[model samples]
Target: MKYCLSFLLVSLFTSCKYFDVEKTTSEAILKEELKTFNWNDVDTYPSFSICDSLISKSEKKECFQNNLSSHILKFLQDEVIVVTQDIHDTINLQFKVSEKGDLTLLEAKVDSLTVKEIPNIYELINNSLNTLPTIYAAIKHDQYVKTEFELPMVIKVE
Candidate 1:
């Protein structure tokens, strides 16, 4: 009788499902819920007015960048910025687009010497950015979030 009772108790305890420690907790679920998504892996790229109707992600991104560069180049041409010397420099432009489609020029990293040599450079860039039409902000995780962009432009003066 003692042996039978002991065997029954051992089997009952071993077969119980309550001791499973692999169950997920609310905190673990909450952490997963609060995870952030990488901006580079966004479903859609930010759009300009000209590229807003494009269906493909790559097309939209390419079109937006092309249009922006075209606008800047056009502005420079209009300003008649003649390259007097043979100099090569890359300018890094940092800007932001708001959720409401407003665009802001954060900073421009141009050679100070170049700027000194070419007066009105800053003004031209600022004016060009201000003249740009409203831009559709990038969508991340289905939300229209403000996004920052870093554009590197190589300028070759001949």
Candidate 2:
């Protein structure tokens, strides 16, 4: 009878060490992930071939934006736009970068004056993107994602 009790006590004390491991709940794990999650941010912005060589995130973004702006500006400058009135305004050009890196013009917000002077300004800007080199979609968690961008273009003509 004494031997049985000793065996039971030793077994119970030895089992306590196995139960010492801390248990994690699913809700706690989910909460932890949420705490570290980025709500509306991407790991990497959509990249262009010209901008791809950049190592820094801000540099890549700047290069992407500048390259796009330069392309549109060059296209606009090449066209001889004759206006009777001295026009100075900004155009908010909105576009979407698809999962396949296709740039689609969503909208062009231009004042009535600018539209009247350059009726085909939207078409011209859209065409500039069409001529762009290959672009890669944005990356988030190692997956490609679509993104939207709005570029404010200032038009100052004498």
The candidate that achieves the highest TM-score relative to the unseen native structure: 2
User: Candidate 2: what lDDT?
Assistant: 0.86
Query: Which candidate number would show the highest lDDT if scored against the true structure?
Result: 2
What is the C-alpha local distance difference test score of each model? 0.78, 0.86
What would the TM-scores of all predictions be?
0.73, 0.78
lDDT of 1 by residue, 1-158 (tens): 99999999999998887766787999999788768545456677678878867889999988977888778868776776665666577888888878777777798899976786677777888888877766888887788888788887776656
Q: Report the C-alpha lDDT of model 2 over 1-158, residue by residue, as the tens digit.
A: 99999999999998998889899999999999999998678888888888877898889878887888788888888888888898899888887888899888899999999889888887888878778888889888898889998888888876
